[model samples]
Target chain A: MKAIYKREVQSYFNSMIGWMFTAALTAFIGIYFMAYNLFQGDAYFSTALGATLFVLMVLVPILTMRSMAEERRSRTDQLLLTAPASVTAVVMGKYLAMLTVLACPLAIACLCPLIIHFNGTAFLLSDYASILAFFLLGAAEIAVGLLISALTESQVLSAVGTFGLLLVLYLWDGLVAYLPSTAGGSLAGLLVILALVCFLVNALSSNWKVTAAVFVAGAAAIIGGYIAASDRFAGLLPDMLGRFSLLGAFDSFSVDHVFDVRGILLYLSLIALLVFLTVQVVQKRRWN
Target chain B: MIEVKNLVKRYGNHCAVDHLSFTVEDGQVFGLLGPNGAGKSTTMNIMTGYLAATEGDVLIQGHNILEEPEAARKCVGYLPEIPPLYPDMTVLEYLRFCAELKKLPAERRKEDLDEVLSLTHLNGQAERLIRNLSKGYRQRVGLAQAILGFPPIIILDEPTVGLDPKQVVEIRSLIRHLAKEHTVLLSSHILSEIRAMCDHVLILRKGKVMACDTPEALEEKLSAGGALELSVRGSAEAVRSTVLTVDGITSCEAQQEGDTVKMMISADGDAREALFYAFAQARQPILEMRPKTATLEEVFLDLTDEDDAVAAQAAALLADTPDEAAVQTTDAEQEGTGDESDL
Candidate 1:
C-alpha cells in the first residue's frame, strides 16, 4: 500500500498534474480572496472559500482523472493486481495519494484566516470550521472523481464524466427545487428513484432475484405508506433530495457560521461510499 | 508446484480455455505451446489471479488462487504478455516499487534487487527511465521485477515476444538459469524455443490440449511410421517397381528429375537395407538414401493444421501410440471421427 501510494504521488508530480492542479486552485482561490476580503474589505474568510468551490469542480477532476484509468489503459493494473496486496489496500493507497495532493492547496488556504485576522476582527473559530468543511467537501468530490476514473480506461472520458457529475452536484439544490412538490408527484418520483436504485443494484450484482426482491419490497413500502397518509407524501421527494445537496451542507458553515456536524458526517460517508465503490469496480473487473 | 483443475474460461459464448488441467512439479521448466488464440495467456492470467476462471480452480502450493489470493500470489511471480510497467519511473525505481509491492523484507530487498538486476543484465540500464528505454530493455525490467522476490514459481506469458533474436536467446538462457531453483511455467508459440527450453510441453489448439509430454517423447510418439527418401539413377517406373518389392513398405511416391528418380517410401519398419539390395539386384545404382525423422515443427503443423489428410495422418500416428487417450480424444473429436460431445 505504501509502495502504491508513493508511486502514485510521485507520478502525479512527475506528470505535472499535481503542479497544475495546485497552481490553478491557488490562483483562483487567491483571486477570490483578493476580491472578497482584501480589496472589498470584507472580514469573513468563509465567503472567499465558498466562492472558490467552483474552482474545485474543474481542478479536482484534473487531479484525479488518471489515477486508476491510466493504470488500466497502460496495463499496469496487472502488476498491482497480481502482487501480494489486496484490492482494498490498493484503492486506499491511491485514495490517500489523491487526498495528499488536495492537502497542498488546503494547506495554503489555512493561512487565509490568519491574513483576515491581521486585516480586521476575524471570527477565527468559525472561519477555521468553514475551512475544515471546505476540505471535506473537496475530499468527497475527489472520491467521486476517483470512482469515475476507475469506471473507464480513457483519461479524457474520466475527466469529462467527473466534471459532468460534479456540475450536476454543484447545481443539486437548484435542481431539487424544480422537482414536483405535490403528493402524487412525489409518490411517482419516489417510485422512479426506487426503480433506478434497483437498476443499479442489478447492474452491479447481476442477480435478478435480489434486484426483484428489493424493487418489489421498496415499491410496496412506498405505496403503502403513501396510501396510508397522503399528506406525508406531499413535498417529501424534493425535501429528501434537498437534504442530500452537498453544497447545502457547506452552506451552514460558510453562510450561517455554524459547524454542521451532520454535514461533516455526510462528507465522511460520501468519501467512504465512493472509495468502496472504486474498489468494487476494480475487483469486479477481474471477474469480467 | 501448481495444480490447475478443469480450468475453463469463457468470454461471452466463446470459450477461451476449455476444461484445461495440468500440473507443474518442482524445479521443472513447463511450457504451454499453442497457436495464436489458443488461450495460453488467458490461462496464465487465471493462474496468476489476474483474471477469474469461469469454472475451475488453480492451486498454488496447496492454496487456492481464488479463495486465498494473496497467499497464492505470494508463491508465484507473473510477467504478463505486456510488461506492466510505469513509464514515468526509472528502471531502478520501478523495480524498487515492485520489490515493495511483492512484500520483500526490508533487509533483503536491496540484495534481491541487485541480484535480479545483474541476472537480467540490466545493471547498466538501471538508471534509465523506462519510457526512454527500448522494448527489449523494458522487457528485461519486467523480468527483473518478476524475479525480485525469487518466488518458487515464476510464470511468464510469451516473454520472448517482440524481442530480437539475440535478446530472445539471452532471455531463454536467463529463464533456464531461473528454472534451476524455481518452477517455471512459460508459454510460447515458437516450436523451437519450446523444444530448446522446456522439459515438458503442452500443445494446445482452439482451447483444447492436443498433446502434453516431453519434446522428445512427443516426437517419438508422433513419428510412428518411419519414412525414407531415396534417389536412384534410373527410370521412375523402374525405381517404383524395385521399391514395391521391399517388405514392410506401405506406400511409395516417385518423382523423376533428369536422369534420377526420387522415391519417398513409407514403411512400418526399417526398409533401407532391403531397398538397397533390391536396387543392387536390379543393377540400378542408388545415388543417395536418407531416413526422414519428424521435426517438432512438422509435428506442430500436423497437429494444428486444418488439412484433412495431414490431420488424419497425425491422428492415426497418435492413435498408434500407447496410452494417450487425451491426445486421441482431441484428435478424434477435431476430425469428427469420434463423439463430438467428448470435447
Candidate 2:
C-alpha cells in the first residue's frame, strides 16, 4: 500500500497534471480572493471559499480522471492486483495520493485568512472553520471523482460523468425547488423516487424477489406515512432530501456562517460510501 | 511444486479448459504446449492465482491458490501474457517499486533490484524509461520483475513472444538456469522450444490435457515403425517377394532407383538383416533398408487436436504397439534423442 501510494503521488507530480491542477485552483481562488475581500474590503474569507466550490467541480475531474481508469487502460492494474496487496489497500493508496495532490492548493488556501488579517480586521475563527469545511468538501468531491473514474475504462467518460454529477450537485438546491410542491404532486414524486430506487436495487442485486418485496414495502410505507400525517407530506419531499445535499450544507459556512456537524457527517459518510463503492467496482471487474 | 486438480474453466457455454489436471514437480522445467487460443495461458493464470478456476483448485506448495492466495502466491512469481509495466518509470525505478510491492525487506531492496537487473540483462537499460526501451529490453524488464523475491515457483506466460531469435535463446537459457532451483512453468505455442527446453511437456488443445510426459517418451510412445526404405538391384516384384519372406514383415513394395530397386517395407520390426539375406538368396543384390518412426511433429499433430475426439482418433492411429514396448521401440531404433526427421 505504501509502495503504490508513493509511486502514484510521485507520478502525479512528475507529470504536468499535478502542477496544472494546483495552478488552476490557485489562480481561480486568488481571483476570488481579490474580488471578494481585497477589492471589496470584505472581512469574511469564507465568501471567497464559497465562490471556489463551483470551480472545484470542474477542476476535480481533471485531476482525478485518470487515477484508476489509466491503470485499467494500461493494464498496470494487473501488477498491483496480482501482487500481495489487497484491493482496498490499492484503492485507498491511490485515493490518498489524489488527496495529497489536493492538499497542495489547499495549503495555499489556508494563507488567504492570514492575508485578510494583515489587510484588515479578519474573522479568524470562522475563517479557519470554513477552510476546514472547504478542505473536507474538496476531499469528498475528489472521492466522488475517484469512484467515477474507477467505474469506467474511458477517461473521457469518467471525466464527463463526474463533471455532470458535480454540476447537478452544485445546482442541487435549485433543482430541488423545481420538484413538485403540491401534496398530490409530492406523493406521486415520492412513489416515482421509490420506484427508481427499487429499480436500481434490482439492477445491482439482480434479485427479483427482494426487489418486489422492497417495491411493495416502500409503496406501503410512503402511503401509510402520508395518510397518518398529511401536513408532513407538504414540501417534505424537497426538505428531507435537501438536508442531505452536500453543496447545500456548505451554505452554513458560506451563507449563514454556522458550523453544521450534521452536514459534516453527511459529507464524511458520502465520501466513505463512494470509496467503498469504488472498491466494489474494482472487485466486480475482476470477477467479470 | 504446483498441483492443479480437475481444473475446469468455462466461458458461458463454451468450456475453455475442460477438466485438465497436471502436477509440476519441484525443480523441473514444465512447458504447456498448444496452438493459438489454447488454454495454456488460462492454466498458467489459475496456477498463479490470477484467474479463479471455475470448478477446480490449484495448490501451490500445499496452499490452495484461492483459499490461501497470499500464502500460495508467496511461493510463486508470475509474468503474465503481457508485461504489466508502468511506461513512465525508468527500469530501475519500476523494479524498485515492484520489489517494494512484493513486500521485500527495505534493507534488501537495492541489492535485490541490482540482482534482478543483472539476471535479466537490464543493467544498461536501468536508467531508461520503459516506454523508450526496445521490445526485447521491455520483455527482459518484465522477466526481471517476475524473478524478483526469488520465489520457489515461477510461472511465465509466453515470456519470449515479442523477442527476436537471439533474445529468445537467451530467455530460454535463463529459464533453464532458473529451473535448476525454482519450479518453472512456462507456456509457448512454439513446439521446438518446448521440445528443446522442457523436462516435461503438457500438450493442451481446446482446454484439455492431451499428453504430459518427457519429450522423448511422447515421441517414442507414438512410434509408427511400419514404413521403411530399402535399396536393391533387381525387378520390383523380386525385391518385394524377398522382403516379404522375413518374419514379422507385414507387407513389401518396391520402386526403381536407376539400376537398383528401392523397396519400402511395412514391418513390425527392423527388417534390415532379413531383407539383406532374403535378397542375396533370391539373387537380388540388396543395399539399404530402414524402418521409419514418427517424429515429434507427427506426435504433436497426432495427439493434440482442437477437437478432443479427433485427437483421440489420431492418437489411436499411431498406438499400434502395446504400451510397454512402444516407449523403447523408437529409442532403440532411432539412436539419437534429437529429432530424426531433421537428420
Candidate 3:
C-alpha cells in the first residue's frame, strides 16, 4: 500500500497534472483573497475561502480524472492488481495521493489567516477552522472524482462526468428547495426516489428478486407512514435531501462562524463511501 | 508449483476458457501454445489472480489464489500480454517501485534491483523515462519488474510476441536462464519458440486443451513414422505392385499420370530402403521420391484446426502417449536431480 501510495504521488508530480493543479487552485484562491480580504478591508480569510469554494468544481476533476482511468487505459492496473496489495489498498493509495496533491494549495493557503492577523483585526480561530473545513470539502469532492474516474477508461469522460456531478452538487441546495412540499406531493416524490434506488440496485446486483423485494418493502413503509400521519410527509422530500447538502455543511464554518462537527463527520463519511465504491468498481472489472 | 483446476471463464455468453486444467511442475519451463482468441492470455490472467475465473480455482504453491491471495501471489510473478508499465517513470524508478510493491526486503531491494537491471540488460537505460524507450526495452523493463523478487513461479503471456528475431532469441535464453531456479510458464502462438524453450507444451483451441506433452512426443505420436511421396515411371498397376511389396507399408493411394504413377504411402516405420529395392527389382524407374516428416507446425495446425476428424485423431494420439511420456518424464527428472539441486 505504501509503495502504491508513493508511486502515485510521485507520478502526479512526474507529470504536469500535480503542479498545474496546485498552481491553478492557488491562483483562484489568490484572486478571491484579493477581492475579499487583501483589497477590501475584510480581515476574515474565511470569507475569501467561502468565495473560492466554487473553484473546486472545476479543479478537483483535474486532480482525480486520471487517477484510476489512466491506469485502466494504460493497463497499469494489471501491475497493481496482481501485486500482493488488496483492492482496498490500491484505491486508498490513489485516494490519499490525490488528497496529498490537494493539500499543496491548502498548505499555501494556510498562511492567509496569519497574513490577515498581521494586517489587522482577524478572526484567527474561525479562519483556521474554515480552512480545515475547506480542506475536508475538497477532499470529499476529490473522492467523488476518483469514483467517477474508476467508472470509465477515457480520462476525458471521467473529467466531464465528475464536473457534471460536482455541478449538480454545487446546485444541490437550490435543487432541494424546488421539491414538493405538500403531503401527497412529497409522498409521490419519495416513491419516485424509491423506484430510482430500486433501479440502481437492480443494475448493480443484476438480481431482480432482491430489487423487487426492496421496492415492495420501501413502498409499503412509505405508504404506511404516510397513512398513519399525513402531516409527517409534508415537505419531507426537501427536508431529507437538505440534510445531504455537502456545501451546507462547509458553510457553517465560513458563513455561520461556528464549528459543525456533524458536517465534518458527513464529509468524512462521504469520502469513505466513495472510496469503497471505487474499490468495488475496480474489483468488479476483474470478474466481468 | 502451480495448478489450474477445471477453470472456466465466460465473457457474457462466449467462453474464453473452458474446463482448462494443467499443472506446472517445479523447475520446468511450461508453455501454453494457442492461436489468437484461444484463451491463452485469459488463462494466464486467472492463474496470476489478475482476473477471476467464472468457475474453478488456481493454486500457487499450495495456496488457493482466491482464498489466500497474498500468500499465493507472493510466490508468483506475472507479466500480462501487454507489459503493464507507467510511461512517466524512468526505467530504474519503475523497477524500484515494482520491487517495493512486490515487497522484497527493504535491506535487499537495492541489491535485487541492481541484479535485475543487469539481468534484463537495462542498466544503461536505467535513467531514461520508459516513454522514450523502444518497445523491446519496455518489454525488458516489464520482464525485470516480474523478476524483481525472484518468486518461485513466473508466468509470462507471450513474452516474445513483438520482438525481432534477435530479441526473441535473447528473451528465450533469458527465460531459460530464469528456469534454472524458478518455474516459468509462458504462452506463445509460435510453434518453434515453444518447442525450443519449453519442457512441456499445452495446446489450446476454442478454450479447450487440445494436447499436452513434450514437443518430441507430440510430433512423433501424431505422425506414424511419416509418409513417402513417390512418382514412378511406369503403369499404375506395376508401380502399385512394386510399392505393395515393401515390408512396412501401411496404406497407399495412387494417382495416374501421362506415363507415370504418383503414390502417397504411409508406413509403420521407415520403408524407403525396401521400396527402393522392390522398385529396382521390378524395373520400374523411380521418377521422384521424398520422405515427409510431420513438423510441429503440422501437428499444431491439425490440433487447432476446425476439422474434427483430423484434430480428434491427433488429440487421441496425444492422449495415448502422455501415460508413457509421464513415466519417461519422471525418469528424466530423477536423472537430472543432481543438477537440479546445484541451482
Candidate 4:
C-alpha cells in the first residue's frame, strides 16, 4: 500500500495534473475569496467557500481522471494486481494519493480564514469547521471520480462521467424538487425508486430470488402504507431525496454555520461506499 | 515449484484455457509453446494470480492462488505479454517501487535492487524515465522488476517479442542465468527459442495441451513415424514391388530416372534391414539408403496443426517402441487416477 501510494503521489507531481489542479482550484477560490471577503467585506469566510463549490465540481474530476483509468489503459495495473498487495490496499493507496493532491489547495485554503481574522472580525471556529466540511465534500467527490475511473479504461470518459454525476449531485435538490408531491404521485414515485433499487440489487448480486423478494416487499409496504394513511404519503418522495442532497449537507456548514454532524457522517459513508465499490469493480474486472 | 491443475479460463462464452494443466519442478526452465491465441498468456496470467481461473487451481509452492493469493503471488514474479511499466517513473524509481511492492525486507532491499539492476544491464538507463527508454530497455526494466527480491518462481509471457536479435539473445541468456537459481516458466510462439531454452516444453493448441514432454522426447516420438529414401539401379516397377515386400513398410513411391530408380518409403518403424535383404534377393543394386528423422519444428507443426490423423498415426507408431510404450502406460495410469479423483 505504501509503495502504491508513494508511486501515485510521485506520478501526480511528475505529470502536470497535480500542479494544474492546485493552481486552477486555488485561483478560483482566490477569486471567490477576493470578491466575497475583501471587496464585499464579508466576515464569514464560509460564504466565499460556498461560492467556490462549483469550481470543485469541475476541477476534482481533472485531479482524479487518470487514477485507475490510466493504469488500466497502460496495463500498469498488472504490476499492482500481481504483486502481493491486496485489492483493498491498492485502491486505498490511490484514494489517499488523490486525497493528498486535493489536500494541497485545501492546505492553502486553510490560510484564508486566518487572513480574514487579521483583516476584521472573523468567525474562526465556524470558518475552520466549514473548511473541514468543504474538504470532506471534495474527498467524497474524489471517491466518486475514483470509482468512475475504475469503471472504464478511457481517462476522458472517466472524467466526463464523473463530471456528469457531480453535476447531477450539485443539482440534486432541484431534481428532487421536481418529484411528485401528491399522495398518489408519491406512491408511484416510491414504487419506481424501489424498482430501481431492486434492479441495482439484481445487477450486483445476480440473484433473482432476492431481488424479487425486495421488490415485492417494498411495493407492498408502500401501497399498504399509502392506503392506511394517505396523508402521510404526500410529498414523502421529494422529502426523502431532498435529504440526500450532498450540496445541501455542505450548505449546512458554509451557509448556515452549523457543524452538521450528520452531514459529516454522510460524506464519510459516501466515501466508504464508493471506495468499496471501486475495489469490487476492480475485482470483478479480473474475473471478467 | 508451480502446479497448474486443470486450469480453465473463459471470456464470456469463449474458453481461452481449456482444462490445461502443467507443473514446473524446482530448478528447471519450463516453456509453454503455442501459436497466437492459444491461451499461453491467459494461463500465465492465472498462474501469476492476475486472472482468476474459471474452474481450476494454481498452486505456487503449495499455496493455492485463488484462496491464498498473496502467499502464492509472493512466490512468483510475472512479466506479462506487455511489460507493465509506468512511463512517468524513472527506471530506478519504478524498480524501487516494485521492490517495495514485493515486500522485500528493508535490509535486503538495496542489495537486491543493485543486483537486479546489474543482472538486467539497466545500470546505464536507471536514471532515465521509462517513457524515454527504447522498447528493449523498457523490457529490461520489466525483467529487472520481475527478478527483484529473487522470488523462487518467475513467469514470463513472450519475453522476447519486441526485441532485436542481439537483445533477444541477451534476454534469452538472462533468462537462462536466472534459471540457475529460480524456477523459470516462459511462453513463446517461437519454436527454436523454446528448443534453445526450455528443459521441458508444453505444446498447446486451442487451449488444450497437444503434448508435454522434454523437447527431445517430443521429437523422438515423431521420428518413430519414419520415412526412408533409396536410390537403386533398377526399373521403377521392380524397385517398387521389391520395397513393398518389406515388413512394416506402409507405402513405397518409386520414380525411374534413366536406368536408376529413386524410391521414397514411408514406414511405421525401421524397415532398413528388411528392405536391404529384399533388394539383394531381387538382384537390384542399392546405391544409397537414408533414414529421415523428423525435426522438432516438424513435430510442433504436426502436433499443433488442425490435421490430427498424421499426428495420431505417429503417436500410435511411437507406442510400439518398448521403452516409449512403458511411459505411455504410466501416463494412462495417471489419467485414470485423475478421473477417479474427479469422481
lDDT of 4: 0.87
Cα error, candidate 3, residue B338 (Å): 45
User: Evaluated against the true chain A, what TM-score does chain A of model 3 have?
Assistant: 0.97
Give model 1's TM-score versus the native structure.
0.94
- Give the 10-residue window scoring lowest on summed lDDT in candidate 3 chain B: B334-343
- Candidate 4 interface RMSD (Å): 0.7
Model 3 segments beyond 4 Å from truth? B229-264, B267-292, B307-310, B317-343
Worst 10 residues of 4 chain B by lDDT: B334-343
lDDT by residue for model 3 (A1-288), tens: 899999999988988999998998899889999999989878889889988999899999888899999999999999999999899999998888988999999999998888888988989999999999999999999999999999999999999999999999999999999988999999999999999999978866778999999999999999999999999999898998898999999899999999999999999999998898788888888888
Instruction: Output the lDDT of residue B249, model 4.
Output: 80
Ordered from best to worst lDDT, the candidate numbers read 1, 3, 4, 2
Could you tell me the interface RMSD of model 2?
A: 1.4
What value does the lDDT take at residue A267 in candidate 4? 95
Per-residue C-alpha lDDT of model 4 across residues B140-237, encoded as one tens digit per residue? 89899888899999999989988999999999999999989999999999888999999999988779887888999876765524578789998998
Colliding residue pairs in candidate 2? B232-B261
Report the C-alpha displacement of residue B11, candidate 3, in angstroms: 1.2
lDDT of 1 by residue, B154-243 (tens): 999889989999999999999999998999999998878898899999988778777788999877765434677889998999989888
**Better structure of 1 and 3 per TM-score:** 1
Model 4 off-target regions past 4 Å?
B229-290, B307-343
Model 4 has fnat of 0.92
Check candidate 3 and list the clashing pairs.
Answer: none
- The TM-score values for the models, in the order shown, are 0.94, 0.90, 0.91, 0.89
Best DockQ goes to which candidate? 1
Positional deviation of residue B139's Cα in model 4 after best superposition, in angstroms:
1.4
| Local distance difference test scores for all models | 0.88, 0.82, 0.88, 0.87
* lDDT digits (tens) for residues B1-343 of candidate 3: 9989999999999999999999999999999998788899999999989999999999999999989999999998889888999989999899889988888999999999999999998889999999999999989999998889899999998999789899898899999999999999999888889999999999998899998888887766644344778899998887887888878777888999999899888777678888889999999989899975456776677667655665665566566653343223322322323311211
